[model samples]
Target: MQAYKLAEQALVGKRNADTVALAMYFVPQPVSRKDGFRRTVNIKANPMGFATGSNLNFDLGLPKLMAKAKPVFCEAFRLEGHYESKSGYPTTVSVQSDSDGDFKVVSMQRLFPNVSQDSLQQLHGELAQQYASAIKAGIAKLEMKTPRVELRFMHPIMIQGAGAGSDEASKLFQAHWQQGWMEFKGKNIGLLGAMKTVADHNKNSVPACKPQVLTLN
Candidate 1:
């Protein structure tokens, strides 16, 4: 209850703050069923920004209400800041891995096809590296104890503002936990828990048997 109040207070008057926006994601977990088979659940968390005109807004009060009602969600969501600009580079990429330790980029697409190959590759590498780092960190933090993981980018990640270029942006995103730079209104949640919160926020319904990603508006 108190956490939601603080978060709301922090978000006050920040609706139109467009230069940078705070974003959060819920961590995913694996569940075992009665059939002796294991599978990941609720991986379709929506990616949203708190800035005005985005999927969420402070006036809706859902974000705050969610923060208060879902302690597990609060404990599991990962928070980060998006420094966006008109010059930002946007792209989408998907990653997959198996129990045999086989990992690779499944597919990638540049939002602007006219962009140079060098620019595209640079953006691709940065996106790939960021996702890989996040996945590995989530696995370690949550102690999921699984050697296999999968990630699919449902939305384009914007790279802009300071050090928006490939090399600099990579460094900035890789070291995303510098407390003094990012804002935290409530309790600090682990990567796994954050992912779960996002899933619930997006209302992802887990299937009876396998893991799947669903796109929600």
Candidate 2:
């Protein structure tokens, strides 16, 4: 399956999660021409999408991956809630937020036209209602529990092909320790545990997974 499809599936059932990644970039808009006609003017948009940020760099492929997945995820969320694309291209969706600035539902729209607008809009309304109902249930769950901090390991490394005569064994060992320090500095919970879980999920085959610590403050 395509990476975008995989991301969409992963995001389908998420609730109260900030699924949208925000970045900064410029957008071109039509302005008055010098001869009293019209011209295109470039203006900076606030909290630009990942694609725009990546566009500024020639060597980076991050934006390309993000661009591909943006629409798939947008449609998936639209099936659950409201999304308003402020700028037509590099679509940016404004999600409704509660008075406390918490999102009631995930908000985003596709930048490309690969999906039908009507289908996406209809899905958005349906998803929004479902999200609202889920929020109520979530509130009840939270009220029943004492708030506490919990951590889980997200990524771990494994030693492979380590031997006395291996050409790069010592270098690999050094790199592992260096990475371990970086992961430890982030105060990640179950860093090792998460790695083990993922390793087992991948059938003990080593896959490179970048660990990021998500802190709820």
Candidate 3:
């Protein structure tokens, strides 16, 4: 079966579980542009309830399923988004990076049932390893049509504060912004990484805020 088809099927199977929504193959154009690449493909599989604003989360087992099936799909596409939640939401398993080279998983939220901190970290590490392996294998076989594209995960601070046009309230808490980016086989990856580091420094140097902005890139 095709990789996307397999991913879609896996997503459908997982959606039958509790409040779980899966969005597979999310290719953001801005991310591509930031990395100096243009993507012609976008693939995704979002769980049904997410669009309706239902409280849906991913089944913890879905990653296992995705891992098992990813070999097939990764050949044509790169997996992105929260493997454990919907877009812009907190999740125990999240995938980021564009379709070309770099990808990272942030399993910060212990939202999965029966998941411990140690176990979550272990899972995160394992997923990262597996994804790297899959991507390498996929790239070896596939033909990249466009100029190699990298993804720059933007910091909310870059788009907010001082000259960013954000309001006083946003600028006041801009120090709380955190960001990261992955460099595919393209440029600006280093720029994005530097931005994230600077943002983290700014956040840490300032006094804590009561309610700070937490934007994940």
Candidate 4:
């Protein structure tokens, strides 16, 4: 149920929840009495009586849920809102049609070319070991795309459907991912690690990390 709602919200965002911000959905727990299971008596209903979904608190936990569900972009150029990479957030993201009503997300790109949810779940489980800080702060939304076209022999796709087979397509995708929280975990020192250097620096002490220079040869 939680996963369903998470995916649902990735598409609809705050639109539907806004309509039900005032309601509350109660999942009453069972308690053991001196005889058997005890239940509640007549709970007061709203003045309008029970609507189909009038008892749910759709406005709850949106932030944490969104933070957990990464933004997925399967196709290029589907981004309807601005992605803020440096800041780790998105703005005005496009939503699927309201008529579908199940609240499923089909356009959000939050994974890489071959990455799977199972792999992510495993990686997330390991967060407590080496990436404890990321686990505590939450893993940044990931981007696992080619990000651009290379002139290698195995290449087969075009740059955003353009004939140009350079790094332009990857750069464009990076621009979109950059608009949100793009996670870099494998190597290259990464943007987050670089930024942390400034935070970890001091005038009086030695640096915790050394400089690394990278070049694409």
Among the numbered candidates, top lDDT falls to: 3
Worst 10 residues of 2 by lDDT: 140-149
Off by over 4 Å in 3: 1-57, 74-93, 97-103, 106-186, 189-217
Model 2, range 40-76, lDDT digits (tens) per residue?
2233342232122111111123245345433122211
Clashes of each: 10, 13, 9, 19
What's model 4's TM-score?
A: 0.17
Local distance difference test, per candidate?
0.30, 0.28, 0.31, 0.28
lDDT of 4 by residue, 52-143 (tens): 32112222243334344422211111112223335432222232211111122212222221236565455444433543332222222232
Top candidate when judged by TM-score against the true structure: 3
Candidate 1 per-residue lDDT, tens place, 93-159, comes to: 3322211112223233223222355655555556556655433333111111122122232111112
In order of TM-score, best first, we have 3, 1, 2, 4
- 1-217 in candidate 3: lDDT tens per residue? 2423434443433333221222433212122221222212222343322231111233345456445444222221223233223532222233333232123332232222222656555554554454442223221112221332121222332232222233543443233233333322123244345445434543454233112578996
Model 3 TM: 0.23
Q: How many clashing pairs does model 2 include?
A: 13
Off by over 4 Å in 4: 1-165, 185-217
- In Å, residue 212's CA in model 3 sits off its true spot by 49
Model 4 weakest lDDT span, ten residues long: 149-158
